[model samples]
Target: MWVQLRRSARTHVASVKGVAWTLFLFTYTDYKTIFFPVTAFACVAAPVQSYTRLLHGVIWIWLNLLQCNSSNQYKSAEEDALNRPWRPLPSGRISRSQASKLRWSLVPICIGFSACYGWDVVLANAFLTLTTIMYDELGFAGHWLGKNFCNIFGYVTFEIGATKIIGTSTALDYTAMISILYSALVIFTTIQTQDFPDVIGDSALGRVTIPIKYPEASRKFTFVAMIAWSVFFSSTWALGTLSSLIFCVLGAYVGSRIYLLRTVQDDKRSYVIYNVWLLIAHLLPAQTRWNVLPF
Candidate 1:
């Protein structure tokens, strides 16, 4: 029984990370700047509370996604057949009904906690909910809409939501704007990097994505352009600081990943390394000077 329980817990954690990384990577900036507001909203005053809130937010985000129709399709049987069964939806570890019941149970807690911070924060959460619903249920992430509007929404919502909840009166400054811009560039790279893994699955589903739209010849240029922009934005955002140096190094690391994607034909390793390297690139700057938690 103990072993079974341990196995179950491990499976859930993998499922959580699978779904969790998207929100986590995109919101790293928020983790740094809005740490206080996030903690307050979660009613956590200490380090422990902050960690709890961080976990809670990720779980809440995942729950919100699971409650949406897109989560089911994305984590559908087809994907499970291709991958592993440890995922909550595909593995039969948790039924759709069970997941829905659990997610529904958290809605009140999510809303109430956001409201505790401020009405604006609550509104921000609403924005997040709507955006995610559209991204998943409407298939925005797999299409052009995700590249345009959804990209903006992810960056803007995190900043606005956390700041409003915290009641921070700080006006948007050059530094903050730079941070947002750098973060947005990173988000776009994430979207592109994510496409390599989904190429087979998305192609099977006839989903439009960067990989689907661009031919092989054109992909390398696009990959290079993304890496260049990453470097440009990071330099602009963290100029003259130790953060800038770290960002430059991380950008090089990400550039190598892009090169691999261009040259490598091995689907499985390329996809997995694309994801792993992306995480490393994002984590580097956050760990260096920012010490920001990724969502």
Candidate 2:
């Protein structure tokens, strides 16, 4: 009986680990794009929340991410196969039909998760769901302008919902709203930086991304935005001279790479650096909340 019990425990442990590994593989790529940013904004905006509340917020974001990624990956399997072959559907971790089922099933799960927070979060999730539909099904992602519009609003919902969860309030205060809008504006301008590295795959598919639409202009504009936004955010956030200098340096590094390198691999590296800057930008709100740094 003792041996049987130990064997059962080991089997259960192995099963748990298997599940965890599967989830990790499905969602790891989005850690930079979604999970980390949402968590950062939440923690920065509401630093005093309980661990349990934060964990619940994490679960909420995870549910929405599962829905978002599964849906987008289901539809973009061909693109992923070309540009990001290791993704679940492209790599055969799941079939297209299976992914479709998982995608649709997550919708209600996300809604239920949001209901715990209130109708406010539910509305936020609903807007994101609508944005996903527009981007994935309505052909919004096929055009550069439509893509940015969807992305701007989609990420804004994420910021708002996450802030509400960790802040333990259905209604965001005025400052939180302003900060989230600032983040949204940041995303609207630079989110297309993600498209630069996908030029080849996008070209193969005849997709029109900002990078593909105006190759020369896109890189130059990104360079300008990086420098301009860095100065704007640092000044508006009232970051100290040293802190602002560090922010500008990161911006300069990313901007220069995007403008100068003009290669797939270089753009990939620059995109990662851009996400780092964006993540730090998300934390700037904490400077408003608490004296995170001194001049």
Candidate 3:
């Protein structure tokens, strides 16, 4: 009986560790991406002064991570088994039943958090949650257009929720709208590069991502997207936004790297470059607030 109890305790600990690991991977990467929208709202609507507002933002970020990770893992188990076999769900570290229970549990908590803010916040959360369900369960990620649409809408909802936290008015100003649109464009154009590394798993699953659909043109498309990205930010810099200048330089550098390494089929290197590019892009809003670049 003591041996049985010890084994049970070890199982529990392992499950906990798996959950923690999954959460860390889901929340930590591009975690700063959440800050971009929140900061954008804070800059335009109101600065984050109170702990209450700050807590609201934090909750949104956490809830977003929970919702995305749970739903994506649940639906993508088969694909992950091929591409990311080491993931908690695919690796047998966490069972599908456990993941489902955890995923559903987050829904009520997210709603409760939103309720504290207002109906608009609740609606935003609901919209995001619903779309995420559709994106994964409905297999929208299988196609290029559907995937991009879902991603862009997800970012919009994220911005809406964050902005609603600090601003009395739900309506976005021109600058805020521009910022959101730019973010969406960035996702729509550049996010597909992430699929380059998963081509094998993606192809096996018949997922029609850019890399899968346009095998020959995918590299050129990414390069052009990066160039466009650089040009857009450079224009902003030209208008005296010093932060934009920094992004302009980083974007150019990243774009050039993409161009130079376009022929390399190394997934790890491609992912590293993509991650760095995304990090810099997400940090741009904070840079705008800081005005770190001296003109």
For candidate 3, give the lDDT.
0.70
Q: Which consecutive 10 residues in model 2 have the weakest lDDT in total?
A: 18-27
Q: Local distance difference test, per candidate?
A: 0.50, 0.86, 0.70
For model 1, how does the per-residue alpha-carbon lDDT over 12-92 read when each residue is reduced to its tens digit? 999898656533332332333233333332221111224444565544443333333334334344654454344455655
Model 1 residue 125 distance off true place after TM-score fit, in angstroms:
0.6
Error of 1 at 75 (Å): 6.4
Candidate 1, backbone clash total? 0
Best to worst by TM-score, what's the order? 2, 3, 1
Local accuracy of candidate 2 as per-residue lDDT tens digits, 15-117: 8986676557678777898899889888887553788888988988888888888888888888998988887778777788888888888889899989988
lDDT of 3 by residue, 36-80 (tens): 444544444333546677676766767776777777888788998
Off by over 4 Å in 1: 1-77, 103-106, 141-144, 163-174, 215-218, 238-246, 261-295
Shift of residue 10 alpha carbon in model 3, Å: 10
Q: Once superposed on the true structure, which residue ranges of model 2 sit more than 4 Å away at CA?
A: 1-19
- Name the TM-score of candidate 2: 0.94
TM values, all candidates: 0.61, 0.94, 0.81
Model 1 TM-score? 0.61
> How much is the lDDT of residue 73 in candidate 1?
38
Tell me the alpha-carbon RMSD of every candidate: 8.1, 2.0, 4.0
- In model 1, the clashing pairs are none
